[model samples]
Target: MDLAEMIKILDRQLTTEGRTIHVDKAKEHMRIEQRTSGQGVSLSLSELLRRYHEDGEEALNQTILAIDRGLHAMASAPHLKGKESKIFPVIRSASFPDHTSDGRRLITSAHTAETKIFYALDLGDACRLIDDQFLDQEGLDEQSLIELASFNLSALPIKIKKDVVKNNTFYFIHTNDGFDASRILNRKLVSDMQAKAHGDLTVAIPHQDVLIFGDVVNPEGYDILAQMTMKFYTSGTIRITMLPFIIEKGKLEPIFIMANKRPMPGKSKR
Candidate 1:
C-alpha cells in the first residue's frame, strides 16, 4: 500500500488497540508521507518512506507487519521502552456491581503483564506516559510532572493531592489517573467517602472531577458553588470542562444553571 495508506492502517490499529498514540511522528508536516521524525514506538512518515525507498514495496510490507505485532503486544503486554511505561485504567467493571448503570464501567483500560524491576506499573496507569529521560528533558521533576498529569490527563494520584476543601471552602480536584479522573471514590478515599461523607458533597472543576465538600442544607449554598466554579474558570487558572454536578445523598444531581438545552417547543405543561 502507499505510505499514507500504510500510516492510516497503523493509526487505525493504535485506535483499535486503545492507544492515544501508537506511533510517534512529527506533529507538523510539510507534505504527505514526508519524513519528519519518530520517537520510540511511534513511526515517522519519512522513516517509513526511507524503508520503502531502500527496499521497495517490501519495506512497506515489513513495517506494516511489524505494526501488526505491536498491536498484539499492546493487547497482551504493557508497552515498555526502557524505563517508562504506558498507563491504563485502574479499576474495572467487576470492581463495582451496584453502579452497573454505565459509570466507571464505561471506562476501558488495557490489561498488561507486570514484571517489577526498579519500579512497578499496572494496567491502571495507562493514561500517563512516564519516562525518566523525557521528564528530565522537559526540565520537570517526576513529582511535578505527575501532578500536572493528575490535574488534567490522568486519574492516577502520584501523592495525596492538595488540601481537601470542606463545606463553604474553596478547593479543587485533580488526579494523574486519567481513566477514573471523574470518579470521586479513589482507593485512598473509598472508605472515607463510604463511611464519612453524608449528603451535601459536590465535586467542581474544569472537568467533572475533584470533589468539594459543601453543606447544601445552607440556603444559597449551591449558588455559592456556581459562583466559585465561574470564578475558578474565568480567573484563568483552569479550563472548565463539564457542567458542575453534585453528589446529593450519594447520587448524581445536575444543577440547573449548567443545563445547556431546553425542552422541545411542543410539550405538555408541567
Candidate 2:
C-alpha cells in the first residue's frame, strides 16, 4: 500500500479509538493529542510506511497496536519521583527530537556524532523520555540521573549470537527487550567483546533493536560490515546510524568504511 493509504487507515483506526489526530500530509506525520491531558505526540509515518513495504500488513498492524499501547501507557505513566530504578539510558539517532512537543528539553547526553544518549523511564509496555520538567519535578540532577541510568543499564541481561561472514566473526545482540541498541552503552559488555576481538572491535547500532560487533581482520570485513549495516539501517523500524564505530582504548570512535580500503576512524565533528 502507498503512504497515503497507510496514513488514512491509521487516522481512521486512531480516530475510531477516540484519539484527536491532526494529519500533516506535507510533513508526512500526524499529531496525536491526548483527550484529557492536552499533551500530545507527533507520530512519524515514514518508518511505518517503510515497515509496510518491507514486512507487509501484519507488521504494520503490530506496529500500530504497539503505538496504541505505548500511547495509553504514556498517558497514564506514573510519577517519576519514586521511579529511579526504572530509569535507563536509550541510544537514539542524533536526529531524534531534542525537545518534547510541549517544548521541554529532553534529557540527553552526547554519545557519537551519529547518535545521542537519552534517558527514559521504563513503563512496562512503553517508555517515556525524561524531560527537563520531569527532572525538576523529581528534584534530581543530571549526574545523579546518569548514574542511576548507567547502573540500571549495566544490570540488564544480554544474549549474544555469533555469525561468520567471509572469515570475519560478527557478534549480534537482539533480545527485543527494547534496549538492544542501548546495550552499546554497557561498558562491561563492550570490554568483554574487546577481549574476544581478532582485530579491531567494530560496533554498529543500525537501529533500536540490533547491536552488531565486528572483528575486522581484513579490508573485506569493513566492506561486509558496511553493507550489512546499511541494509539493517534502511530496513530498521527505528534507525540509529549506518556509520559504525571502533572501540579504541575504551572509547567509541566513528569510522568511515570503504569497499576496498581499510576502515579508518574519523575525527569527531562534535
Candidate 3:
C-alpha cells in the first residue's frame, strides 16, 4: 500500500481501536535504548551509509525495513512481564544466611513493590536519556536539554493529561531547522497534522495539502526554509528556535500556526 493508505490505517487503528503502532514504536524504542544503555543497537548514520554503499539500496532498505518491523511488533505486543530475580534478603539467604522460607516470600514481596520505581528508572529514564542525546545532535542546546529533561521528569503525570484529549486531537511539532523537517516530513502519519509549511518549514497532515494555508519561503544566507506559526497543538514541552540570522538582522520572520481547526466534515484530508 502507499504511504497515504498506510497512514489512514494507522490513524483508524489509533482512533477507533484505541491502539496505535506509533505508541508501540515509542515503547519499543524505549526498551531498546534501555537495553543498550542509551546507545541504540540499531545502525548509526555511518553504518547505514556503509551498508547502502557496499550492499546496494535494496539491502540497506531491507535492513531498515526489518528494523521498522521489529519496532512495530515490539510496540504492538500487548503484554510484557518484568522479572525480579534479585532482592537483597533473598540473595543473602540463598548465598550466606540460609534464612527461612518466609524470608523468601518477604524478599519477593519487596521486589514486587519496587516495580514502579524500576520501570520508571529503566524504561523512562533510559528512553529520555537516549532521545535527548540524539535530539541534542539534531539541534537542541543546553537550555533545551534542561527543558526536555524537566518534561521527561514529569512525563508520566503529563501523559495522563494528554490522554484526555478527543480522538481527533492533532499535534504539530515545528522546529527552526530544515534538516529536522526533512527527516520527519515523509512520514505521512505525522505530516497529516501539519496545516502549513514555508520554505524549510513543512506542515504535517493538513486537511488540504493542495490548499496550503501558508506560502513556502526560501530564506537567504541560511541553507534553509524559515517560517513560524501558532496553531500547533502542544501537550508537552516544546522547543522553539528562531533562526539566528532573523534575530541578528531584526527581521520580522515568517509566522504560521502549528495546528488548525479540523476541516469541515466531508472535506478531504489532503
**Candidate 1, which segments miss by more than 4 Å at Cα?**
1-171, 174-191, 208-211, 234-242, 248-250, 257-270
Question: What digit string (tens of lDDT, one per residue) describes model 3 on residues 1-270?
Answer: 333433343344333222223323332221122221222223333343444455565644454444444344333322112311110111011121222212321111111111101111123211111222233344534344333333433321111011111222212323321112122212332243233322222222111101112212322202111222222211101112221111111111233222342211112222
TM-score on alpha carbons, each prediction: 0.34, 0.90, 0.17
Backbone atom clashes (below 3 Å) for every candidate: 24, 0, 21
What is the lDDT for 14 in model 3? 30
lDDT of 1 by residue, 166-254 (tens): 33433344443333333443434433443443444455543222334443433344566666656543322113333355543454344
In candidate 1 the C-alpha lDDT for residue 22 amounts to 35
* TM-score, candidate number 1: 0.34
For candidate 2, what is the total of clashing residue pairs? 0
> Which scores greater on lDDT, model 1 or model 2?
2
Residue 162 in model 1: shift from native, Å? 9.0
Estimate the overall C-alpha local distance difference test score of candidate 3: 0.25
- Please list the residue runs of candidate 2 whose C-alpha ends up more than 4 Å from where it truly belongs after superposition: 16-18, 35-38, 44-47, 266-270
